[model samples]
Target: MDGPPPLPLREQKMNSEEKSFLLPKGPSRLPVSGLRLKRPASDENEPPKVDRKRARGPLDPTKRGGPVTAAPCFPKPPPAAPGLRSHRQAAGSRRTVAAAAPKPAAAPAAAGGGEKKRAPWDLKGQVSDLRAKVGIYKEKAQGLAGENEALRQRLNQLEGELKQATARNQQLEGQNSALALELQTCQAQATESLQRVEQLVEQEQQLQETIKSQSQTIRELESAGRKAREAKEDLAAQLEAREAELRLAQESLAQRAQENEALAARKAQLEQKLHESEMERRSLHNAVQELKGNIRVFCRVRPLLSSEKEAQKPGMSHLRFPPDDSKSLVLSKAEESHVGRERKEDIVYEFNFDQVFPPSSSQEEVFEEISLLVQSALDGYHVCIFAYGQTGSGKTYTMEGPDCQDPSTAGMIPRAVQQIFRKAREMEAKGWKYHFTANFLEIYNESLRDLLVLRPERGSELEIRRVSQCTEELHVPNLCYVPVASEHEVLKLLQRAKANRSVAKTNLNERSSRSHSLFQLRIEGHNANRELHTSSVLSLVDLAGSERLDKSLSTGDRLKETQAINSSLSNLGLVITALSNKEAHVPYRNSKLTYLLQNSLGGNSKMLMFVNISPSEENFAESLNSLRFARKVNECVIGTASNRK
Candidate 1:
């Protein structure tokens, strides 16, 4: 078969930039139909040229336009140039290549007698030497030509700029000389003016001195003439008055001596009585200090319905300090006050831990307003917010919202937990960090069960342990404290507990808390400034709703449970009543509710009570009793230290 024709340079330019080892295009890339050759057109058939360049893969820009001629192509590729092939096999492979891809249809290279001639371009042994010398000379010529052009352009620009600079410099120099002359002339004029001013000041000083000497001489003559008239008038009056005054002086001395003796006696009597009265006052003050408890009392009220008469909205029975009367709340001796019946919502009055309500109109809404007090606890104070409300009066809703995620309907517990974690995070300067350990327990079925605890059959019998923030002590018999970091974690815990809570569909709360559930959070941390541990106990307790036997269809097991819930709540009221009166006996041990809150109701704690009241007409009596019990609680004073007023 004949070798392929030489490819045209025009086709090579099309794929010049692609990286190819030899060539990317095939031998047929040329205009095959327009093939120009020595053969006649009559021979319409000839073996087609195989373009081996197709297998070259890609092209390289560096290997662009160069001489190309077909070489012999065998089943195998041509042998490498000269040193690239071995001596024994080089001649045979070269012969095969020249025959396989003949340079062109050049009359078969005029077939020599024995062997075909090789094309001049295929004489690699001769072209290599010529290519190396040509490359070096070409690079040198390009670099010199670039430098020559840059120098010519730079010279022309510099000459033009130099002429313009010279002209500008002359103009600036002329302006500077004129300014320097003006400065010199101004200095001379200032010096002359200064000399004239000094001369005028000296002449004025001389003239003023001459006038002052003349005025002094005239004043001295006037004083001498006035002294002569004064001497004659003084001599006449002095002689007559001296004789009469001597006689009266002797009588007055005798009367003054008697009066002095009487005054001294009266002064001694007043001093003796003053000292006795002071001693009595001090003794009483000391006794009062010993008896009185400085408990902080804050009044919190819930909103009333807009349609109700203003006077009945809060039920006048819940008022501690009259709502419309600000002066009464500010009074040093305000004993009783009126409740605001102004249009609002369900009314609740929260007071101190040791306050009592007589159930009049001034009842305490203990759970309704505790966010403010709990917020203060996060600010580094031991705070306790307890609910004192009848069952079914929204107590559970007040402390721990049944719907915890909703802030508007939030009860005390979720609100308290949210505030504590928030304040702890905000205490940046105190290097304050608070670890919250949550323990949800309920005094239910008269037995303590961890609400977060798995049912006995569902899981192992987990222990309920009490944790002590002091001395890092933890663990309680029925309550286990779980450390929580965020509000979301608390909410999830609440939701889980609510699901696990022993709820019965009662006439009151459909999912009423059957037992006293204590959601206790133990807050302990160090103050950023003092670096000392500050600890507080926070409890959001939801007492089971109070139910009327007549209205409730509860029986059997339900009745017993209701009885247990009521008995414990009653004991709670007694405990508050005893504390309010400063009674030596606080019945904390009377019930589980009171016993659990013993520390909170006593010393150094900021205790607030929310008496949750449901304005529903059906629950009014229980609400009224609840308010009266709350009012009694308002009178009790719990002892505390370090309250930020």
Candidate 2:
């Protein structure tokens, strides 16, 4: 029987369900099953056929075209009952038979127009074919089940990988952002570095220019240094030549020095000869003064006083200086004649002295005459010079100047002091040194007093004593003997003595010296080169005014002072007169003044007396008395004085 009239051609092919059972799944499905289905060799060249709808299932919006998740497994159908199974099998058989059968076609067969023919039916053949197909389907189904199990395992693995990949991707994204920020920072740093590089490049360029200029300067300096070195060499050569010339000059100087030394020796010899000549001259001069007489006298006539001139008193008409004789003074006094009518007769007296000074004579001119005698004292001769005169006769003014400070008015004492000191200094060049000791004393009321003492104690009398029993030299005990270094020192002593000496007002003179003042300088000299030494004393005496008591308007103390002064004066005159007559016993101890001057008045001494006479006519008799006493002193010839050396 024809199997259900041949099925249509469309029905004869495999259905969609069967095709799906045979096809592979989409790309999302894993082929986890080890079993692979191989296509028939005849289909190798053909493209694979897939169902579009199943390949692109419902997609998740969030996932886009990503993988799809595994589907859930469905429960398998249970085995059918035997009879049903057989019936299903027969149906499937019938389908397969129909599919295997060729399509019916209208052919030239069947000459009978339109007579349909039915093929012969084979039941066993159909059953066999259906069983084989059923077996193939069972095998495919089992493989698909196994593939699904494997696919489930593979899907779990892929899901774990996907999660890991997603975490890694997020981490990479964070790192990328960090790296981008770092890139931005690095870019900013690079920009700053480029700017710094530009500034450094500018500095380097400037430094290069400076180096170039310095290099040129160094080259110029080197050239200058070479020139300076050459100049230094030339200077060195010139210095050497100068040194040679200096050596030659030094040699010449040495020769000249030798010649100068010879000249100096000659000069020394000449100076020695000069010193010898000076000594001879001093000796000759001393001999001359001795011949003139050791005891000498000088007469000085006092100038008329201003009071006499103002009162229109009788002028010094009685006193006259010889017109041609400097050594003589003529005194003429007009006396009344008793027999005639008031006719006055002239009594003329002429006195001669060693030197007579007129009113016009200067102190200097007077000192000049005695300066040589003063020098004799330095030659070891004891010298005594005294001024003897009546009151107000300029006796003090002659011995000591009215103003000792005035060189023009300075008298014999100051002028002699100056000359002594000056000569001492000059003699120092001759290897002579002189030491002087000075003492000033006054005889008041016939009592010895030390004028150099600042304040003399009341009733303290100084006594004259012999310096040694073997010598006639006399000195006053407790007298202040000062060592004098210069003339100024001696002058100061003179001033001090002048202040301390006794002075009193008298009718004859307002400020009459009431005491005899004596200044004595002891000179000791040494000449080392000549091995000579000399010691001598220079005595200067200013005798008290010798005015008669009646003329002096004496009373009480004044009368006593006048008597004492007159006694001392008379004693001095007696001593001179005795010496003149060559009396064996001289009255030296009769008064303090005479005894103290023992050595100076001896034969081994030089003596000078200044007889000062007043020019006033009222004092003519007193002047005459002083002149007579001085003449006696002048006439006495002491023996030749010898030097102490």
Candidate 3:
């Protein structure tokens, strides 16, 4: 009642603010015990009921880290308006009357004992106090009611908002789930894009490598093309050169063909002229041989011998070569026709022949006269050239020569052989071939010995048989016909024949051949172009020396040799006589010499007789006998020569 000492200004201001302010009580105003702070028309001991159905609110920043505290309590609930505040004021007035009842007594007693004094009873003051208190509590209660109402409204609003918020959260969560799925798809796409980028990078590298290899191949192809182009150029150059050479060869071939054609025409013309000339010459040759007689005789005079030179003749020489003609020989005799006659008056003898060789005439000059007859053998005519004279009258020398050393002195046989060889070789170009056979034999005492045989014994049996009687050409059976190719071969054969010839020492001659040596040449030729064959013979004979038995002073074997020689010579003379007379039976069988020459003497053959004569005065008788025989032979005509083909 003495009003609690006047409140502090700060406290008064806080109370006034509490009364005036509408905000609710905070935790700071709550009692420390279990009781809550009081309010107008509200119970103090009952705690303020919180609506547990309310949702939790946001945290308070002011209460951070503070002790746990409940919401502050306030008076009971009232009407939402100020009516609830009047009721609480009436209740507070009743409580004020009851408190005034004890205040007077306690005040007096305390005054007597000097206790605290009581307030003066002023209605305005008491009412003011009580009113003030009620007002404060009423305001507090109102504020509390207002706060509760606000809180309830807020909770209800929060509940509705929270329901809406929860729905929104659910919608947001669903949206988030969809967004996360989309994000995962985006991430996968991004990852895939990265992988693709890596693959692209690898492909680019491979493309780069491919481009590099292609560049290298392009380089190789370019190089090959260059080489091929160079090779083509070289081949083109070679083709051009070969073309030029072919052109040159064609021109040369054309030229050669033209020349050959011209030459062939000229050859044909010359051959025709030659054929006509050969025919004319052959006819003329035949007529000449006919006029001269088939057996033509030639006389050769020997030069002065050594004995004649030692004993010179006092008068003019008996032998003289004619001044008017070379074919005539004149011999003058100082004595009469008979020996030791007084009426000498210089007997004169003149001889004419086909040819007459003078004492000084060379072998060539003599061969020139007889070479034609030798040539007739090659022309297919059987020809005979016989040396018929006494032993020392140069018969062997004229036929075979002194020796073969001097070519100019080579006789008729050697010259004829050389000519035959030359002609045969020349004819080869004209398509003619010749086979030549040579045989040399000697008739000694009517026995034939082959001169060409390698060796001969003293008593060898050599047979000489005649060819068939039906054949005209004389052939000796078993006679060796050695084939000869050259002039030297013929000369060799002649040497062999000479070595084998029968010779003896006689009074009139130191070495006289005691046998008739016959060298036979058989020529068989064919003209390949004409296909005509021809056969002929050339019989070259060197007869033995014709000697008088008394003049030679022979006896014993020498006499027998002389008799045989004389007998063959006499038979040859008889055969000649019979041929000259054109008798039906010419004595060809009378002697071996005549028999051997049967075909050459009287048949279709040309016979040339060389009558060699000595110029020595001591051999006048033998010379006269040879001259007379030559004259007889010159007059004889055996037959017309015919070539055998």
The clash numbers for all candidates, in the given order, read 70, 0, 0
Ranking by lDDT: 2, 3, 1
Q: Against the unseen true structure, what C-alpha lDDT does each candidate score?
A: 0.50, 0.70, 0.66
Better of 2 and 3 by lDDT: 2
Winning model by lDDT: 2
lDDT tens digits, residues 1-645, model 2?
A: 334533321221223123322323321121112332232455434554442221112223222211223333323334445446435544643553343232222111111132222112433223233333233323333433444444355345434534543454454456556655755665565566556556655676677857666556556655655655565566557556545544543443453355346435544543454455456556656766766689999998877778877754565678887676677889988888878688677999989888898898888888888887898988889999999988788989999988537889998899899999998997775678999999988888887788777663645678888889897667776778899899999999989888888898989888999999998999999988778899999999999989786677899999999998999999998888888788999998898888888888878899999999888787889888988888888879878788899
Model 3 lDDT per residue over 1-645, tens place:
255543322333233223322333342111112322222343334454432222112223223211323344444433333345435544543543343222223222221232122234332223233322322322323333343344344335324533543453354456446645755665565566556556655676667857666556556655655665565566557556545544543443453345345435534543443333344445555555555567888888888876678786753378887565756888888765565556758788888887777777888777866766776788788898989888788888888888546888887888899988997886674457999989999998888888877554435556646567876655666677888888889898888878777788888788888888998889999876567788988899989888887688888888887888889988988988898898988787878888888878876888888999888877888888889988987888666778789
Query: Cα lDDT of model 2 overall?
Result: 0.70
Candidate 3: C-alpha lDDT? 0.66
For candidate 1, write residues 1-645 as lDDT tens digits.
267743322232112212111322112101112333243443334444332221111223123223233332224344344343334243543443233221233322221112222233433312322232233223323332333343344345434534543454454456456655755665565566556446645766676765565446435434533443343245335423332332322322332334334334433433333333323332332232223333433323344444434536345343445443321221111233356444344445333333222223221133323444565455445556655555555556556664536666565566667767776775542245677788887787556677886676334433433355453233456355678999889988888787777877786665666787777777777544444565667666667877768777789988988888888888877876777677898787667677767756665555665566655444556656665665576566665434321
TM-scores vs. true structure, each candidate: 0.43, 0.59, 0.59
Error of 1 at 357 (Å): 17
